[model samples]
Target: MNVALVTGGPGAATVGPCTAAPSPDLHYRLPSAFNDASSKNGRAMPIDLDEVPSRGSQCASAGKRRSWIPGAAFLAVLFGSIALAQSPPGTPPPASAPADLRQSKGVLLADRPDDTLLLAVEAFDDGSIGLVVSSLAPRCRVPEDVFDLPVQVDRAGFQLKHVIRQQQPQPDGACAESIATVYQAEHYWPLKTATAVTLHLPWGAVPLNEAGLAYLKSITPARPPPALPDDAATYSGLLDQLTELLAAGRNQEARAAAEKVLPYFVQRPPDEGGRFFGILGTARRRTSDLSLAAASFEVGIRLLEIAGDTHSLGVVSDNLATVRRLQKRLPEAEAASDRAIAAFESLDTPGGKASLGGAYNNRSLILWDQGSPELALVYNEKALALLKVAYRDDPQALRPFLEDNKFLRKAIKTP
Candidate 1:
């Protein structure tokens, strides 16, 4: 009964091409499910990754075949750990960790409890080492001390100590629910002679397995630069500026900025042009300009198709469907939703499956709003089935979608 009604517009998870470098400042918030659940009783209960249900258990309850597909945001967080080495432009750098706590080369350590603590060590070509420490905690209880904690490193390994403080009652005597918070700290050290390194966290010690050690050792001090068009840097800078504006929730400014720079990408490669259009569409949608949003997405889809970027194509197509739905263009919305599902189906990857489920959910909403409750129910069930598989390990993340499905079913059953 923790379900909240699905009001307002559809969920807007931003999208970009998989291979494109993300803006260093771009930070994604946890899904609305977490936000909603945290505030339900004013007790800010964040989902602990350690308590996630087993895949077999979740699948058995859903009565569907279990499939493992990582959510898009989940994967993004994993990859984003490495990018944390440098603070965003204009942000003050944090206090350095003690001298003994030298950083190391970037390698994702496995064999730790998922989503608890992530440590990414990156070795830069400049002989500098970077370490990014990340952990999740309740919004009101961030562990700011993790940044300055001393790390002990020796030929054997490195050890970092962290202790989560208990949540003290708020000044108002009640903790307000807020989105789950991720606290991260970056530290740098001078590179030293190559040595096998192990990370000892408070929970456990994780050694660099053979592959990790080899990867750390094999990193070239410098990489050959790829040939680039003269305007590449300018183009990248423009996109980065736009991404920053959007991430900061400056919707009107982002729309204007996107429009100003969009023409530059028109004659570029399809992927480049498509990426611009996608940003433009997102900005327009956030500004409540549905017509322009749909137009941008349509153009982006064509360019992505020409570029053979099915992932971005699926994403833009879904965005178009949502815009068209808001515009009450049922036929067009349904067609766009179908296209998105088809594009995701072809990819068959974990991110693709997660997106495919979202497309199904979009189609259900469109059908229901178009007065086809029966058909909507069918699509909703299909969406739930796929999402159950996609989020088998993190059922808490699936709560919002489940709540939406429950609402849809109840509405359909009502006289």
Candidate 2:
């Protein structure tokens, strides 16, 4: 499975938040997920692709149910006619075709085989047109040359219609085999007055088939996107700088950066709440502000628990335990670590198991300091085994824990 977002700074000379390793899961907030100030946290409020506007839809048609056509044979027929400039010698002629067909007017034509092609058209208020065309072949991609599609719309009563060419065709990577492409173009015609239009592709003047035309007309127009919150960009920039500063062991700078974004924590969704506060807690811990670190982590934990974000909850709780340990709050620290372990166990992934290892190690340290070396040894050993798997990708990543385990082993041997 792909690892989720893991954001934390490195630790100091001893075991702490940074040394307590969690797998890397960077959940960057892309613009598409949250266009406006309020919609920034889509993890808790994921946008429905189908409900998005036609021009701005981030929909993935991959893995959906589709009535497919025989791709190879159909393309062969369509392109074959183009290559020879005529129908095959023995092939029957196409049935009588319609005239003055246009996309906006909802002109319908006869259906082709299921595996042929699918097209969706969207017209905007500013005379802009968007087209989504997909090749239905199971393993075939749309030929690169076909992307240079040029078409002319034949409006009734006008001697000539507007001609448009695809300046760009963005490929949709979601589909495994078929090529789903989107084209955005503009026309000079008055969209409302156009009674009929015909698309003149390289192969021929293809009328909008019934299914294609219906699908195009059914699309909802996109709304003008909302503006972002004034502080959104600044807050994000600060968090990024904080992560970098913490990574570089510049605790003071990291703490200051965290403070800049801390006020906005309440406005974030659970996932982002856990992320920002967790980062803040790290900065506070590195600077030895145990109380502030614990406070930040508590808020983060509350948000994660409310959102059922167990994965982040587990990592942040582990960090909180470390801060509590530094403050000599043994009971509180142990309790927090226990919660972390529980959260990790529930995750059941490699990253989760690795996080649990860090929690176990922290608990072992607390137990050792409390004069229970024998009991601490058991937890330490368990931590070592789990951490080995967690850092399997880079054994050096486990160096700190490996050294700690070795020290614990030698200490337990003493009288």
Q: What lDDT score belongs to each candidate, Candidate 1 first?
A: 0.49, 0.48
Cα deviation at 297, candidate 2, in Å, is 0.9
Question: What is the TM-score of candidate 2?
Answer: 0.44
Provide the lowest-lDDT 10-residue window in model 1. Answer: 177-186
For 191-263, candidate 2 gives per-residue lDDT tens digits of 2223344543333455665454445545543332223344556546545656776778766665654453343
- TM-score of each prediction: 0.44, 0.44
Where model 2 places Cα greater than 4 Å from the true spot, the runs are 1-238
Which lDDT tens digits does candidate 1 get at residues 304-384?
788788878888888888877877778988899888889989986887788788888888889888998788878877878
- In candidate 1, residue 164 scores what lDDT? 17
Q: What RMSD does each model have against the real structure? A: 23.1, 22.0
